[model samples]
Structure formats: structure tokens, C-alpha cells
Target: MTLLLSVALFGIHSLMFYLLKINTDSYSYSLLELYGFFTPIAVFIIIVLIFVHRKNKDAVGYAFMALTCIQMAANYFMLHPMLQQNLRPQKINFFILFALFLAMETIITARILNNKQ
Candidate 1:
């Protein structure tokens, strides 16, 4: 699930950049910044989730949902200004993409949490 989500996001991101004709250098730098800042925190959360899952699957699922929410919030806060300044023309597209991503994430998380397994 995670791998699928990652690949989908990457493809969408790349397509957005291509279709919008965004400044690749600046956009790439921003993405690098986001990755560098969030990767460690995301890894730590996943590690903890793994441990928690062994004890309580539901708890881990909720944690994953919360983690996804936090990540979306952080992305919005961190990227909004950059999008406004650099990708002004494509800002709406970015927001739409982000909203779609969040909706998909929420659905996926809910499904995992509600699973009887």
C-alpha cells in the first residue's frame, strides 16, 4: 500500500511539473528540502508503528492515520508559500492534487483501520 501510494505520488508530481512547466530547479530544491526534513521523522514514526502493530494493530492503524494527517498539514504549511511564489500559475492545480492525495490517503487509512484482519 505504501509503495503504491509513493509511486502514485511520484508520478503525479512529475506529471504536474511537466504539464505546468514549473521551474524544475526551484521545485526540485523544495522537494529535496521537504524530503530531507520529513524522511527521518516519517521513518521514526514507521518504526514505532511497527512495534505498536505487534502489540495492537488498531493502535498502529490509528497512528498511521494520524501520521498521514500530520504529514499533510506539514506539507501544506511548508509548501504553500513556495507554491504561491514560484508556481503561481499552477497553484490551484497543486491544491487540487494535494486534496486528492489527502482524500485517497484518508480512505486508505480508514480501510486499513477497519479491516477485520
Candidate 2:
């Protein structure tokens, strides 16, 4: 789940670079900044998942649910700054994507937890 979120973020970052015509250096920096920002949280989740899986394999799905929450939080934080910026069409598209990702994450987390039980 964590990897999935990372991949999604990377993909979005790439798409943004292409569509926004942002400078290559700026695009690379933005990607690294966002990726670096999320790294510690993802590592913590992985550590917890490792420990939980070691104690009980059945709890792995719960780890994924936890990851969903973390990813959603990351997404929300990523956009928090954008919300203050002047509105633009691309930013609006990003907002839609953000909301859609959150909704999908909510559904995925619920399903994962339900199956875990």
C-alpha cells in the first residue's frame, strides 16, 4: 500500500511537470521535497507492519489500512499549501484528483479492515 501511494505520487508529480511546464530543476526539487517529506512516515509504518506481521501474520491487512490513512494524510498535507495559492485550472484539477484519491483511499481502507475482521 505504501509503495502504491509512492508510485501514485510519483506519477502525479511527473504529470504535473509535463503539464505545468515547470522548470526541470523545480520539478525535480518538488518531487524530491514531497518524496522526502513522506519518507519518515512511510518508514515508520513499515516498521510497525514488520513488527505486527512478525507477531501475527493476519494483521498485515490492518497495516495496509494504516498505510491508507497515512497516504491520505500526506495527500491532504500536500494540497494544504496549494489551497492558499491563486486558483488556476491546473490547481483545480489537482484538487479534484486529491479528492478522488481520498475517496478511493477511504473505500480501500474500509474494505481492507472489513476483510481483516
Candidate 3:
């Protein structure tokens, strides 16, 4: 789960950055720079949570849930304002990713809890 989540997260972030470069209309170096900060912090937190809670798979799911919640908040407050746009494609995708991450985390947690019982 950790590996899969990490890959997904990396791929999305990379795609966003790459797209920003190719598209002049959506270009915002300041926003990209801020997102860069989030990228590293997210990676660090995910790695730490995965390793530190390796023995407990359920705990890993919880960590992902927590991270997703934080990411959602960051997306709304930091990313949204910096972009200075409403109803953009990138904004839509951001919410989609957040929902997907939340769903995955919730399912994982439910499965883990069931297995324990």
C-alpha cells in the first residue's frame, strides 16, 4: 500500500509540474515553487509513516488517511490562492485526487480492522 501510494503521489505531482511547464496559460512559478515545498514534506511524512509503522499495516493506512487530510487542506488554502483561479482543471483534479486518496485510505483501514477481529 505504501509503495503504491508513493508511486501514485509522485506520478501526479510530476505530471502537474510537467504540465505547468508545457502550458503557458497556467504558468505560475510562485505556485509551483510553493507546491515544491509540499511535495518534499509529503514524501518525507509518507516514508516516515511507512517505515516507522512497518509492523502494523493498519497503522500505515491511518497514516495515509491523515496525510490525505493534510494534503486536502494544503490544496485548498495554499495551492488554491496561489493559482488565483476558480473551477480550473488543475483544481478539479486536486479534489479528485483527494477523494480517491481518502477512499483508498478508508477501505484499507476497514479491511485491516476486520482482519484483526
lDDT (C-alpha, whole model) for all candidates: 0.60, 0.60, 0.57
Q: What would the per-residue lDDT of candidate 3 be over residues 10-47, giving only the tens digit for each residue?
A: 57766875887644355333334544545465555556
Residue by residue across 1-117, what tens digits does model 2's lDDT show? 655776777788778778977655422125555556555555565666566666776876777687767777776777677666665644555555456544544554445445533
lDDT of 1 at 37: 50
Model 2 segments more than 4 A misplaced = 1-21, 24-29, 86-117
Candidate no. 1 TM-score: 0.51
Residue 82 lDDT (model 2): 64
Worst 10 residues of 1 by lDDT: 26-35
RMSD over all Cα atoms, model 1: 4.4
User: Which residues of candidate 1, in runs, are more than 4 Å off?
Assistant: 12-54, 57-65, 83-86
Instruction: Determine the backbone clash count of candidate 3.
Output: 0
All candidates: TM-score = 0.51, 0.47, 0.46
Q: Who wins the TM-score comparison?
A: 1
lDDT of 3 at 83: 66
Query: How does candidate 3 score on lDDT?
Result: 0.57
TM-score, structure 3 vs. true: 0.46
Shift of residue 34 alpha carbon in model 1, Å: 6.5
